[model samples]
Target: MTKTKAAFNGKRLFIRLYCPREFKPKCVTSSVPVTRKVSNRASKRIKRLAKPMARPIRVTVRSGKWKKVSYLIKPGFRNKVSKMAGKRKRLLVVRDRIKAKKFAGRKFKGKSRTVFHKHRVVSGKAR
Candidate 1:
């Protein structure tokens, strides 16, 4: 279950290169003098972006991850999240957080994986 979500909403690579010309690498990445530097630059830029976005995606009502996004957080969703949340006050709604925390040593342990961590599960003080 956890593994599936990890792969589903996986991260994406977005890059706008500084390749000043159009006669780019004919086939692929190469040692050609002209394109090598450009390609390397692009690669470096990608690496930089990856590092920042690579942070674990945690789910918390307080967190802004799901800010503008809308999902039908109705009774069914509440029930599912409650059943999952159980006693723990954390949940990994996005998926990667589960992998990052390695399920928090319980193979189910996660950080801020609290389904309703902010509403009623943990306490009225969660807000």
Candidate 2:
């Protein structure tokens, strides 16, 4: 008798936010707050609003229980995986949380930190 485990590959996909280097040079700077005793809140708000954001990146998990599935390099694989991942609401929540966190900090953390916010099964693997 022969025993064989089913072929299984698990991947995790998530979105990342960033600010393009060029955007910084083009972003408008907020005016200096009044030198008076009044609140500087308005200027702070302007500064945040003036911050620029670049298009988000869809990233696959790399080096973990779920390994990075290199679908982007394969023809048509990117679209297939994207469509599958799109149906998972958990990924959207993860994206939104990251967006809110960046907005609060007024900067892009990019891929500096590891986030394990949520997970869902996509196709046959755990994403």
Alpha carbon lDDT of each predicted model: 0.22, 0.26
lDDT by residue for model 2 (81-109), tens: 34434343222122111221233335544
Poorly placed runs, candidate 1 (over 4 Å): 1-72, 88-90, 95-125
Q: Candidate 2: deviation at residue 87, Å? A: 17
Evaluated against the true structure, the overall lDDT of model 2 is 0.26
Stretch of 10 with least lDDT, candidate 1: 27-36
Model 1, span 1-127: residue lDDT tens:
1211111111221111111122121111111001011212356665343222123222222211222121223332344433433354443232121112232233323222211111212211111
Residue 65 local lDDT, model 2: 20
Best by lDDT: 2
| TM of each candidate vs. truth | 0.19, 0.17
For model 2, state the Cα shift of residue 52 in Å: 32
Give residue 89's error in model 2 in angstroms: 17
- C-alpha RMSD by candidate, in order: 21.3, 18.3
Which candidate's TM-score is highest?
A: 1
The per-candidate count of clashes, in order, stands at 7, 0
